[model samples]
Target: MEKTSGWRGTREIWIEAAYQALIESGIDAVKVMPLAERLGLSRTSFYGHFSDRDDLLKALVTLWQSKNTGNLIRQTEAYAETITEALLNVFDLWLLPDLFDSRLEFAVRNWAHTDQDLARMLEDADQVRVEALQAMFFRFGYDPDYARVRADTVYLTQIGYISMIKDRPSEPPGPRLQRMPFYVEVFSGRPVSDAEWARFRARHPVAS
Candidate 1:
């Protein structure tokens, strides 16, 4: 393990730099020496934050899970009174950048193609996210097998969306957001009221 002396700064600075590098270039560009140079500090400062490059990579995965999967699960539990509401709450992950990062997710997913360890980590994270979504469905009275399928459907759809959209998500939210209620109906085997639809539109207010 590497050691450092008197490095006084938050680990976020390094992680942010790594995140940028990962997004801009690829995982190989997220090196301690390069990051240290970018930050105008010695590589020793990295040891203050992470033990090595593998540690930094692990941190990046953790950050992605915490910000994307964790945030979506929190929103699902927080906003969903009904199955329709639950689906829209989860849809926010694709519709809004504030709730998740499509580019970063794409970057990590692409990286995973080359690294078995990263692939495993991502697979595990996927399971956790699906389970969390399943819990949300179960709370609304779905059976375990039914909820599991619904949860996988929602999670995989979002992942597919991220995979397809290569550029910064410039797609207008209005048209797509309009279809969310329909998607909810399909996924949950439930109907959405006009009032519920109106309320959802009011909350999002996507332009046509």
Candidate 2:
């Protein structure tokens, strides 16, 4: 039986260290020794859970997929009365960091610039997320082509925000929340009903 190191951090502790390094300094900073040092553990402790650096990297990717893409897909499936309400459900991702980690998303996209495999994974995630949005539009009676276009519009717009917000200081949600009704009208091609806006505001009271 393999002897476990006493006082060494668990797998989650190591992965969280790697996650923070990646978010703060990009992928190159996610080295095992550095992470071990940061955790005040011996380098060998990392091998207890992950075979090597590659294994840890894969775990990070899995975490990103599960947290970011998974939440976005789930939000798209949330119950809503109108297309406007449905879109607002998805928009919760932007306001709720617990739902989606924009810094991690941006970091992974940056990492993908040099990693073909990660690029492919990122592409797959984008396709899956867009498809979820398309399905939501379909539920609201949008035709196929229109749904596709609108889905791309909504997905790309959020992605654009993610990219633009990278490296910038965090901003208040009020500005964006104030403009949400207009965004809903434009994205859904219909006015946001007062009830829908009220519900959305109640769901996100920080901006109120």
Candidate 3:
């Protein structure tokens, strides 16, 4: 057990360096020798942690998902009761995709050859985020299944917009999320009064 834990330390250090390399140089630039150099270790030591570049890359993707999904889940837990606060938590998570620093998502979109583990991580994150949005919609008095479909659409829209920008999010107000509350209002058969719209934007405000 102690022997295994010690090797994981070296692996984690190399994973962290690869993450930084992905951020600074893009996913394609995250090569083994460069990562080893960045970690101030020899390539021989790198091989001690990972068998090859693809192995290290796969580990880095796992670490990225662990951090990203963990934070989103933590945020949702932090604001479990308040619908507005919960929605805010979702936005906070969505606002930082560029920090992943990999165009690998698009690269893998239609390619069946993509890494299965990374694909599964992305899928699971999407599923949990939709679940959070559906929970918010139900609290606002909408049907849960209907809300899940709407939430799915809203998530797709956010992904499209984020892909277009591809940098620090200059997140706009609630209109940036038009279809989200629109899904709530229309699905619940409620009219969105100007006063209520004002309240939503004022209460949410992109970020605090």
- Top lDDT model: 2
Against the hidden true structure, what lDDT does model 1 obtain?
Answer: 0.83
| RMSD from true fold, candidate 1 | 4.3
lDDT tens per residue, model 1, 11-123: 88889999999989988899988888887778767887788898888889999988987797788787667888777777767767778888899999999999998899889
TM per prediction: 0.83, 0.94, 0.60
Q: How many residue pairs clash in each candidate?
A: 0, 0, 0
Clash pairs, candidate 3, are: none
Error of 1 at 11 (Å): 1.9
Candidate 3 per-residue C-alpha lDDT over 161-201 given as tens digits, one digit per residue, 9 for 90 to 100? 64665566665744556655564344344555555455556
Q: Which candidate leads the pack in TM-score?
A: 2
Every candidate's CA RMSD? 4.3, 3.1, 6.9
Q: On residues 92-156, what C-alpha lDDT tens digit does candidate 2 reach at each position?
A: 99888899999999999999998999999999999999999999999999998999999999999
> Quick one: how many clashes does candidate 2 have?
0
Error of model 2, residue 174, in angstroms: 1.2
Ranking of all predicted structures according to TM-score, beginning with the best and ending with the worst: 2, 1, 3
lDDT of each: 0.83, 0.91, 0.59
Residue runs of model 3 more than 4 Å from their true location after superposition:
1-10, 24-26, 94-117, 167-208
The deviation in Å at residue 8 for candidate 1 is: 6.7
